[model samples]
Target chain A: MHINMKIATKYIVVAILLVGFTSCQKNSRPNYQYMPNMYEPIGYEAYQESDAFANGVEAQLPAEGSIPRGNFMPYEIEDTNEGYELAKASLTNPLDSTQVDFVRGKELYDVYCGICHGNKGNGQGKLVQREKILGVPSYDDAGRAITTGSIYHVIYYGKNTMGSYANQLNEEERWQVTAYVEKLKAELEK
Target chain B: MKHVIYRNLTSRILSLGFIILLTVSTSLSAQEGDVAKGKSLFNANCAACHKLNKPMTGPALANVEQRLIEEEGLDREWINNWIRNSSALIKSGDAYANKIYNEWNQVAMNAFPQLSDQDITDILAYTAAPPPAPVVVDAGADAVVQEPGISNDLILGALAVLFALLALALVLVKRTLNRFAEAKGIDTVIEEKRTPIWKAFIQNQFLVLVTAIFFLLASGYFVYGYFMQVGIDQGYEPVQPIHYSHRIHAGDNAIDCKYCHSSARVSKHSGIPSLNICMNCHKAIGEVAAETQQEGLKEYGVDYNAEIQKLYEAVGWDGTGYTGETQPVKWIRIHNLPDFAYFNHSQHVSVAGLECQTCHGPVEEMEIMYQHSPLTMGWCINCHRETNVKVKDNGYYTKIHEQLSKKYGVEQLTAAQMGGLECGKCHY
Candidate 1:
């Protein structure tokens, strides 16, 4: 009986230890890799931390006045009130009727602008409806009769509480979205 | 009796009229503007740049009329002029207007020539109204959350005590029965000893061999499973610096994944969103609603406002403007492909028009992000073998697709038939 008790206690301890080992596999840390060197890149990966730059980051802003290669067109308007007024009056969509694709425009608009601007541009967006954001004006608002030029300017420079969306949408894509916004405005007016 | 009834009716009518007169007088004394109308107008026009009690892009505007009259010695006429055209007011060299313009970063307030005098009065009345009281969490909810934990422990304790008592009672009963047997002088019969069950089983050679073989096979199977999962980081969930709840943003708010990860549609990688993308909405949303905050605290154990403060710190936003001292948020990347394998986001996202959720799994339901797919080569090959290439409106693949369809003798060609299974497509 004494020998049986000893063996039973030993088995119980082993059972507890086994349970502990399996339960200790944590999800908060990464699993062990067989060969980490092959998995990790040697060259600088996007958003990697490095001492190579002054800022100690892999991502770097382009040098001032240096343009990107291929289809590069500079935005000349300064981010100021006068610049906004000038753009509002003068800026026009470069894409002609054949080039303007409303379907593509709507897709881009839904991804980028529809969260706050609403799917129909009537100011009652999901965010606005949830009261997370407010004071988003409708496209047909009389106080600010947004024109094609004005809409493009606001998107590029981001007037008031809005942020510039130039980085998200390319120049041609912006024109496409501008054309879509005009369509929404016409519908809202009707 | 008739005289008494008549008197009572006349008194009651007089009191009802008096109550009506009091209500009318009180409403007249209060601003002639409708409060409800003012609130709707304020939310529509002013809430973008201003909060009534907090300093947003503009200064807090609570009790502005009274404060302006007392402090600035300005009246309604000056305010109306400023509201209509602040730039014009500043151009006219009004001291207060110029002071405010410089104070708020020279950002010209949009001219609202559309608002008439009555509208302005209504808005001002709304502003003058007292701020709503802070929301108190329901005491019943707190009790409900706490009761289960207490009761569960209490029940367990009672069960344990009862079990111990029963065990003691059995031991006592057995000891008394043995005592009674001893007093009665009854001898308990002893049985002859035999080989133990384990000893008998060991003596059987065939049974021993079978048992040994079973143990070897079981251990081998376990070892294979352990070795196979060595490099694959399936269900890997690392803690991030900021606890951004995908459930709240993607699920509750229904924001598109592309809204933040804009580069996914055109680039090799689905880029981590910059702080500016977060600031776009967070500039206006300084704090979460009370219910949302409470929910976060109870369910997620997170202070959402504190997390927003962390975002502000990283982005260098000092409530009103950029402070120009920013720190990059070190987000731990989750889904990483090995350097040897070639993968492009735009090829799959823009070309195939695959939903982000296809590979990411039900991300909207995930509170903490994790690796959804095994992302092994076999898994990729399996998908390619099953998924037909989307050929419609794809000019680049139309001719090749037709050729491949004829070669395979199938109307729809799978990605594998389109040379997707070639090693050089990914490895080289």
Candidate 2:
């Protein structure tokens, strides 16, 4: 009787464990990591609070006028109408025609500008076409005919109804986008 | 009485004819440039501030010429001057201009010094025309968009139901057979002392051997699987600080994934986007949409508006400039590789041109982000083995392709054939 009881208990335990294993669903909780230190490194995450730091600041701003290595040349134009006028009058692309990669520029443009400005640069993008945003103009329009400097200026310090893309794109990338926009504008005019 | 009725009908008809004639003459005279030309011009200059049917940063410009003339006592010349330079008008202390400026939150209308009188007239003409009816793109898009969320629960439920029915049928059959045996006066029940399970198991060597082997194999397999699960986080979905729906941003709105994950093309990590990136659109779209709010967040079980409030708190944006009291959004990281394993996002994303969804598992459909792939070494090696090196257009691969194709004696070479499995390729 005792042996039978022991066998019965063992089977019951086994059955319960098997049920528990199957019943526990995927995405219920995070499964155990063997060595968490390996999975989650000892390195500090960007913008994460650390015990070593006071006031919980990790990503500190660089000194004013400092530039990262291999980045674009520093843009001097400030975010102002006078600055835009100055850029338009004087600033030409440092990159020549050969330096421009319209393909890369198109890729960047699609990511950033094609939502509001149509893929064809015809001002009928998904946002404008849906009437979510009004008044995006075609590049071919006489009043909206833009130069490289004007495009760069607007990208650097956003114009009316558009926000600054400076944070999202580096200086070189902004130029790439400008080159692409010029291509689109030329195409529309043609 | 009949003669009086006829006279009344005739007078009414004459009045209607006169009104129609007046409308026809005004429309004829009011026509300016080609309406199409006017529309293009309007989109360029006037669209930034004005909507024809609704008010935006500037007043609704429907019947704008009439309104400005009749209501505000401003003529075409005054309107033309205002278009050229509203700032000058406001500075000159024009009461109407100042009032307009003050009403519009003092956002100065940009000067159109380049605009000719004809250009302004064309824009005015476009505005005078009736607003176009909004076009609704097909309902078929939404209907076709939803991929069936297939899971194993359906199969499991069916199996459970089948087993229950089978058990019921078996029990009933057994009882019926026993009663029939008794009715036939056949001795079916032995009524002997039952053998202990262990003893019975021991007696049946074949059964014991099979069960032992199965147990041994199953346990061995289970133990191996458990050990393999060490660094493999297949479904490690942690609750994020805020509920940011990829479905809404990436799926429904068709926002490019790279817009948020900008660094994936250039950097090592598929970097988390900064809060400023979120602000690009969120500044305009402050609240959770009414329809989206109705559908509760299934994964986090959090309210939609409450999530927006959390974002507001993180960015310290009170619908205007920064409030200075800010907290960074600390999203729980889902995919993490070991420190020794080096995975360059640019190498796979930019150079190799693998879609983010290839590794990320249809992120557009994901409401809450989770680790869809196992992120296992085996998974990586398998992909490298199967995937072909795209060598057609890329200049960098041309020389390598010639040599590798010669070496392998094949027309097309896979990633593995090009030394993708070399230890230094990943480990270093």
Candidate 3:
């Protein structure tokens, strides 16, 4: 009777252990979500391809030359040498000194330009240090006597070897970055 | 003494070479404007369309003087004339100039009427100058040999040995006890003479009932727990189109999360990076190192070069000009909140100033990215209840902050107190 009891207890313990072990740990399978239809609503997801849209397009941009409300005046300078010269000669930031937040500007600049233009603006960014890119000039370098307009122009239509950050950063953010870069340039000059 | 003489000779040779180089550079500077002046002129006038060593819209100007004078038999004066009026030269049917125009697709060179002969010569000097060597290059991530400490396997082996030794000791003690009992003339089988435990247990009805009830309750609790965890996908790591390692980029290289996912601060969704953004870095960093190949990548059986090749193919970059043929990488979306739920990355990441890891878990450590959080409503509500609203320094939260602090009667307020738990806030 004792032998029988011992065997039965061992079996029960093993069974309980197996069940417990199976239930534990992170699982790849998802738990049941009720009303799965509510989970996947029939709405326009940006990149999700569906035949619901015309030309089988996913995301659509607004038509060209239409400005949204509460936006700053659009840049009129063409992406040409003439335009660069024009901007360098005349274009100025509309945001006054009070509106220009150096803290936010620094944050934006670090994100967008610091990868290539160094956090300190010494032209020794990580990519440059790693030999991934060469010949990024310092702000204090004699070759590039860039003005605020020139910086704005560069951000809008990128200079040589540099891609435009227009898609990544908006106009306000771009102006902020320009302000921060100007600050760095002043520091380097000092 | 001979070794010392040889070392001295070598040092002399090196110094002589350096002196000759310095003189030549100085003479060239004298011939043109100084090299620095040439560099400035080149950058101001020519950098838009030209490179020193690489062909962009215009041919590289490396050894342009030598090539033009020696190879093409063109006049030294023609370069000045060409820079000043390339279209005029091409139109005038100057054989060499037209040959040049035809060689490259008939793209008109920009007229730099402002540049003097000295500026042109300096630009040429700057272009011919060899590129400066990299001053600093730290050995990238793979060189450090981390000393691995006592692994789980070693601990497990030691534990198994200890357990066996303990079992043996216990058996030996039992045998000794039995022997002692036998020597005392007390039968060791006295244990067997007692009623069997199961029989005794069965005979006590009240004890059996209580024991049965406790077991049923425990089993029921476990069964419910197992069922409750049915659809919550905690670790659903799907394969992405590219084997992009967040550990390598975000962790090893320490690239900021927002560098690639730039739209996260502004938009509803944390945007997938466009191919152009990838090109910004990948245009130069084309392949992974052999050391990385042998490390984590080897364990996963991934070929790094092939994955890079896939990126090149998608982006239509053949190492030179973009072919303009492109295809979007079909990355499998992992995190899918149900339609009823509303989650804005800007609201959490930008407004609240939460770290990416708060919801994404330790993404920098994940080789294959996964959904780390349960991402259920309970998870969201729990976070809202616990998290304090970040109200300082934001212009958007000015009026809201004053009212919230007054209502709650606290300086610092949790998200729940700020109406984060309102059903319409997330649901509608």
* Alpha-carbon lDDT, every model: 0.88, 0.79, 0.79
Each model's TM-score? 0.89, 0.72, 0.68
Clashes of 2: 0
> Residues B240-272, candidate 1, lDDT per residue (tens digit)?
888898988999999999989999999999999
Worst 10 residues of 2 chain A by lDDT: A23-32
Q: Per-prediction DockQ scores?
A: 0.74, 0.44, 0.29
Rank order by DockQ, top first? 1, 2, 3
Model 2 chain B worst lDDT run, 10 consecutive residues: B141-150
- Where model 1 places Cα greater than 4 Å from the true spot, the runs are A1-24, B1-27, B138-140, B148-192
Cα lDDT tens digits for candidate 2, B1-428:
47766778878899999999989988876886456778877776677667677565577788889898899999998888888877888888988999988887666677777788888788888877777753332343334433333335667788999999999999999999999999999999678788888998999999989999999999999999788786577877777889888977888778888888988988887888888778666554555544455455333456888887788789897764458888877777788777778899989998999999999998898888888999888999999999998888999999999998998899899999999899998886
Candidate 1 has an fnat equal to 0.80
lDDT of model 2 at position B155: 72
Model 1 interface CAPRI class: medium
Best by TM-score: 1
RMSD of 2: 7.1
DockQ value of candidate 2: 0.44
